[model samples]
Target: MTLKHQPAYIIKMRAKPGQGDRLFELATVGMEKSGASDRFVIAREDEDPDVLWNVEVFRSEEAKDAYENSPLADELRDEIIGLLAEPPMRIPVHPYSALPAAPS
Candidate 1:
């Protein structure tokens, strides 16, 4: 279950003025529906209410590319773009380590 060499990214997005919540909601829904990654997390920026970050680790680059280029993603992308103040930014990274989730 290691994401050691997986295609991972930290995507930064800023919502238009007061749309952060809506943006987060929609993005969460998209991620859940796509099931394109091994792990994905959405978090709000503590110092900036309008900013949100999406951290995702896909099983492989092909899976990542396929999901990103799919029609479902395209539609969600357009809607997401409309809620953004500006273009989203992505920072790629390599996961060298990971810990399994604890039991509920």
Candidate 2:
């Protein structure tokens, strides 16, 4: 079996009142349709009444890229952008590790 890589992204948005719920719903649905696994709501911080933060981790960067290019992604992006009070903040992460076992 091929091992999947780790990909994590932190998305920060300043959303208008009542917009977070819709954005969350749209994102979750789109991610699932694009082959994402182990999805969960990581955290929601109330920086203020009009600002919010979300951190989500995916199984691999390939999965995340596929989701980004989906038709649902386009729709979600448009809708979410319209509701955002500021540009969304996005950061990509790649982690590395060394296996304990080595070939002789």
Candidate 3:
């Protein structure tokens, strides 16, 4: 299976005040539990600890849409939104090239 041309998202979230760690924790757990993406990663900004960048690559567009519309996703979204300083920003993209997954 190749991830070439896969749909992905780079979601930028800013946690409220000191909620950065909590936000990252919840987001990570949510991603892990969802099983919605083949590639999931979360990174914190160096300049601003409160800023987080979540990257996800899905197997297909239908899977992505289904995950986004799921009740579990809704619940997680609410929980995550409560910790945010502002609405999360989602940037969708298609992979031009990607390296293979590393050994587990």
Highest TM-score against the true fold, candidate:
1
What's the CA RMSD for each of the models? Answer: 1.3, 6.8, 1.4
Give the TM-score comparing model 3 with the true structure, all chains together: 0.91
For model 2, what is the error of residue 3's alpha carbon versus the real structure, in angstroms, after optimal superposition?
9.5
lDDT of 1 by residue, 44-91 (tens): 989998898999998888888999999989999999999999999999
Name the weakest run of 10 consecutive residues (lDDT summed) in model 2: 93-102
Error of 2 at 5 (Å): 3.4
- The residue pairs that clash in candidate 1, if any, are none
For candidate 3, write residues 2-104 as lDDT tens digits. Answer: 6876789989999999999999998998888888888888999999999999889998888888889998799989999999999989999877787877899
Whole-model alpha-carbon lDDT for candidate 3: 0.89
| Decoy 1 TM-score against native | 0.92
Q: What would the per-residue lDDT of candidate 2 be over residues 1-104, giving only the tens digit for each residue?
A: 12226676667777778877666666667556656543434345655644555555566677767777778778878988998878989887543432343568
**lDDT (CA) per prediction:** 0.89, 0.64, 0.89
Ranking by lDDT: 1, 3, 2
**Which runs in model 3 stand beyond 4 Å of their true positions?**
none
Q: Is candidate 1 or candidate 2 better by TM-score?
A: 1
Task: Report the Cα lDDT for residue 10, model 3.
Answer: 89
* Angstrom error at residue 44, model 3: 0.8
